[model samples]
Target chain A: MAQEFIQWLSHPGLNHFLIISGILFSFGIFAVLTRRNAILVLMGIELILNAANINFIAFSRYGTGTLDGQVIAIFVIILAAAEAAIALAIVLNIYQNFNTVNVDELNQLRD
Target chain B: MDLFTIVFYFLAIITLGAGAVVVFSRNIIHAAFALLFAFFGVAGLYVLLMADFIAITQLMIYVGGILVLVLFGVMLTSQVLDVQMKSGTIQTFPAVLVVSALAGTLVGIFWSTPWKTTAAAPMEVTAAKIGEMLLTSYLLPFEIASVVLLAALIGAALIARREKNA
Candidate 1:
């Protein structure tokens, strides 16, 4: 069993990348679910986006011979940037309206 | 282990460790700094995947542009540095339980599924091919993405701007 595990570690196949992406994705989810700050939540969203990008690049390299996954990853990156800009602007607005940046305190819309 | 495997392990550790810091750090400034390492590590992983162009783009756009903007946002906010910068979480136990369950399910699916794999081919310069595809096959998406970016820039500026009289 020990030798088998060593061999698995040395190969560094698709499953390894998948596992890394999975862990990153879960961490992002945890941050988004639990964090009170809006900006921190945005960072978690970025983490989720990066995890998806990793999965895309890994599959593109290992699975199909085409560059479709890479192309989609590029698009995803572009969208992520745009999303971050708009989200941060909204967060700034939130801060301006309320004295705090905490999501829990922004309960005025909780009708 | 071979050099490729060794490098992969190192990059994975850096990326995941930085990500943990980003998620769990108390100070927002420290989390932003940790995010820089996480983005850098992801760019390194991009190199390992042979997506050289995407790797460079990730470094340039993510590390250079968005992270700086995020840091500015964190610093410019009032009282961010003095006090109330604590990024506390509510219901941490439940969140961890849910996240762990989801991660386990994802890992199981990843290992059990039969992914289609092909032999590793010789590395070729992918930037030119990606550029060509952006122009030809994905021309519409390419143009649309630029337009979206333009709109986002304008919208963000408008939203964040303050009234002169106020």
Candidate 2:
């Protein structure tokens, strides 16, 4: 059993990549849920996007063996860039208008 | 272990450890810097997976372009940079519980499923193939991505510019 597990670790299969992506996704969610700063939240979103990208690349390499997944990943990266740009712009705007970047404290909109 | 396996393990550690720092670090600057390693590690993983073109693109667009913009955002929004920009966490316990459940479920699904895999050999060169596809089948998306980037550029500039009279 021990040698089998060691061999599996060395092989680094699809499940390995998927598990790592899962862990990354969990960390991203934790950051999004726990961080009050809007910029930090945006960072969390970036992490989530990256986790998904890893899965795409891994699947392309292992499962499909086509460039389709990589192509989709490229588009996803482009979207993430645009997202980070626009989201940060919005965060800066919030800071300018409200003098704070805390998502929780930006509650005047609710009222 | 063979060299490839060792390299894979190294890249995975770098990726996950740096990602951890990015999420858990209190100082914003530290987190941002740590993210550099995370991105680099991901790029290395792409290379190991034989997505050479995507790996280079990741390095250029992420490590070069996006990271620089993110640093600019950090500096521009914070006003003062001398003090530690300590961003605090909230609802930590509940977040832990929720994230644990989510991760467990995902890993369970990943392990239990019988994923279909092909034995196609990795290409020696992916850049030319990717380029051909981009100009051929992915032509519309290629153009659309450029347009989206242009719009984002204009919108970001408009929003972030200093309004002297507002």
Candidate 3:
């Protein structure tokens, strides 16, 4: 079993990419949930975007023809840029209104 | 092992390590820099996977564009007197449990799946072909992305300007 696992490890198989992307996505989720600062949350979102980008590139390389994977990756990049712009604007607004960018402190309407 | 496999493992390790840093770093600026490393590692993986166009786009967008935006946000909002705004205890146990479970499930799924290779290896499709498609068949989406960027630019400027007035 150990030898078989090593073989899989050394294989440039699609499974490796899938697993790596999944791990990255989870780390991003962890960052998003755990981080208090709004900027850190944005970074987490970027990480999540990258994880999706990895999946797209991997699929583009290994999957069937037609270049759909590349197309999807292009869209992901476009969306990420838009998201960053809008999110940063929101963060700046939060700073102006609340005097701090701590996401926890922005719960003014929670009560 | 073959060259491709060797390169894949190396890039994968780098990507994972940088990703871990992005999550675990306490300082927001440090996390942003670590994210740059992670993006570079992912681009490396893209190159290894023969997605040259995607690799270049990753480098251009994630490293060049998004990182700059993140750094600007970090610099603009950071407390100059108290740089250590990154707290220690936010969501500790739940994050650990969730991320660990996610990682385990992904590992299990990867191990269980059976992947088959193509009988004929993928042809060397050049970046020129990608450019050709971008200008031709995918022209609509490409044009749409440009308009979207323009809108984002105007929106960001508006938000920043609103602050100066208020």
List the candidate 1 regions with Cα displacement exceeding 4 Å. A109-111, B162-166
Candidate 1, residue B150: Cα displacement in angstroms equals 0.9
Worst 10 residues of 1 chain B by lDDT: B75-84
**Residue B158's lDDT in candidate 2:** 91
Model 1: residue B161 alpha-carbon error in angstroms: 0.5
Considering DockQ, which of the candidate structures 1 and 3 is the better prediction for this target?
Answer: 1
DockQ of each: 0.77, 0.72, 0.64
Q: Which segments of model 3 are wrong by more than 4 Å?
A: A109-111, B83-85, B116-125, B164-166
Cα lDDT tens digits, model 3, B68-162, are 99888888788856856464548789889988998799878866877554442465765777777788988998999889989988998787668
Specify the highest-TM-score model's number: 1
Q: Across residues B1-166, which tens digit of lDDT does each residue of candidate 1 receive?
A: 7889989999999999999999999989889999999999999998999999999999988999889889877876648447777778888999989999999999888777888899876798999999999999999999999999999999999988854336
Which candidate, 1 or 2, has the higher lDDT?
Answer: 1
lDDT of each: 0.90, 0.86, 0.81
Query: In angstroms, how far off is B31's CA in candidate 1?
Result: 0.7
> Which candidate ranks first by DockQ, i.e. highest?
1
Q: Which sections of candidate 2 miss by over 4 Å?
A: A109-111, B79-84, B162-165
User: Clashes in model 2: which pairs?
Assistant: none
